[model samples]
Target: MLFATEVDAPGVAALERVVLDAERAGYAFVTFPDTPRRPGIEAGVRAAYLARRTTRIGLAPTLHATTTEPFHLATQLASLDHASLGRAGWVVGATTAAEDLATVGRTGAGDGEVADVVEVARRLWDSWEDDAIIRDVATGRFLDPRKVHHVDFEGSGFSVVGPLITPRPPQGQVVVIGSDELTAVLDVALDVALVRATDVAEIATRVAAARAAGAALVFADVPASFDPSLVEGLVDGVHFHGGPPPVITASPHGATLRETLGLPRPLNRFAVTS
Candidate 1:
């Protein structure tokens, strides 16, 4: 299976070293934590910067669903996908604390609101079809207007109209990650489900439930010192909290996040089907 870890810091160089070491150690992805009051660099900004520096590891940053504008988040993520050439994922969460809401000048939101934000993000990602950008300098035409679809999304808390400023991502859609608490929202749309149980039996139960609910991948948040392979069959991957990922060996040949995760490169949603 795949392995991952979380790294957080104020210095870009330190962050880069941790990520690069993780990649060298064979971790499939590196994640950054996000919270309204979190110290250090913003996760999205760090991921974008890391995207330019690393090639194979997935660059995923935590995205708060409640406070951020869905449309902007969608575009930023699409841009990250371009920067990383397909390796992009969003660890999405709803704002829980009142302070976080206050910081964004918004009211607190629940999982339902978070789910809506995610849906809007997905809609916007697909708004600009893959071939929308035709950049045909010879014809003097830049895009096929017909290929861009208006979202016309009206959710309980927000509404968005028209095509996204960004085109569809290389992964077709950037991977959407959600925690176990939001399974109700995630089951229908998320690409990965994250669980925090350390017990093997509990982990297995969570894995079965997530799979039954239609999650394509289930990742257990493992402790730094634990061996991930022991539970490899129970879950699709292990996300460690710190340093050299336990058990999983680094790949000398190098591999992309999709390759390590065993997920195929998704066909563009706008691609013509026979």
Candidate 2:
């Protein structure tokens, strides 16, 4: 099974040290949890910075669907994927805290709205075909406009028009993960589901249910002090948070996050074929 951990360092130096150490220790991926408690760098920006520093581990940053614009959220993640050489994942979040809402001057997003944001982000990622960039110096044309299509997605309270400002990400689409509790309430599919439970049996039950709900991978979210062996056979991976890091086997080296996780790169939905 694979293993992952959350790094909530207070400063950039500490962040780099933890992430690099995690990579050397053989973790598949490292996530940055976004919260008011740690207020300096935004999670996405921190992930982008670490993308250039770490070579093998996947970088996933918690991005809320409610506070950010869909277009910007999609673009930021697409940019992260490019910077990380196809090793980017997004932990989908929808915060309902009154303080968070006040800062954004908005109300909490419903489950349907959150699901729509995820769908729109995915569609925007596919708006540009893989072959869209055709740099022909002789013709002086940088791209084939025909290969780029408009997403034209309308959902919840907003609408997005045409193609994204950026091209498709290296992984075709960055992996999307959500908490099991959130996934159960939303109607969107996730690449990975993070399950939190009290015991091994509950973890197993949640993992099974998450799989049934269309999560390609299911990870048990446990405290860093928890034993990995307890849920060894029950999950595809273990995601640790807070406390000391758990001892685990190393993940395979020199592969993208999707590759390491055995998740296939998705096909561009707007691509044309003969």
Candidate 3:
């Protein structure tokens, strides 16, 4: 089983220290939880900043799908993947809290809104094929326009047209993660599922449901203070709330997050596979 942790440090210095420590301790990834209660640096920006500092460890930042613009969100994440050399992940969040909605001057997102946002982001990532950037100095051409296709995603609340401003990320697509509860309710596909439960029985049930919902990896979200034996063999991995345990045997460093997670690089939808 793999181990992961959350780093919610308030400042860059503190966050860097904790993240480095987690990397040393051998955790697969460190997540930054973004919420109204914990007001601080944006999660994606934090990940981008640390992308230069560390190697091997995956950086996943939480972003609310409900309020954020899908086009910009997709672009930002694609850029992060580039900055991190394909070691980026996104925790798709949906919030209906009064304060959160008020901050964006928007209404609450429906049940499937998070899924819609995820789908649109995936499409945008694929809109630019792998070889879209030809950069042929001889012909004075930077890219092949034919290789970049329009996504034309129309969701319930908003619509995105054509290709993303950013090129396709190094990983083709950044790994997508969501809470087990959220994935359970919506028909969303996730690379990883964070299962939050108080005990083994609950963890098992949630893991089963998350797998049924098409999550490739299922991890239990355990509190900072908890029994390790209760969940060791039950889930694919464990995501600590405050931090990881004191002792962890690090896994072999994989070049990218998807590589570390044993997920294959996705085929570019816009690529011509003749």
The clash numbers for all candidates, in the given order, read 0, 0, 0
**What tens-digit string does per-residue lDDT give for candidate 1 at 85-152?**
88888988676789888888866665467778888888788877777889989999999887888879
Give per-residue lDDT, candidate 2, residue 265.
85
Off by over 4 Å in 2: 36-38, 272-274
Cα lDDT, model 1, residue 2: 72
lDDT of 2 by residue, 77-158 (tens): 9999999998999999878787886677876655488899999999999999998999999999999999988888888888
TM-score of each candidate structure, all chains considered together: 0.91, 0.96, 0.95
Candidate 3 residue lDDT tens string, 1-274? 7888888876789889989988888788889899744566788889999999998799999988887889999999999999999999999888879788778887566667888999999999999998889989999999999888888888878889969988999998999988987777777789999988777898899899899888999988888776666887878888888654456786775899998888899998768452
- Sort by lDDT, best first: 2, 3, 1
Candidate 2 global CA lDDT score? 0.88
TM-score of 3: 0.95
> Candidate 3: misplaced stretches above 4 Å?
36-38, 243-245, 272-274
Model 3 error, position 123 (Å): 0.4
Task: Report the candidate with higher lDDT, 2 versus 3.
Answer: 2
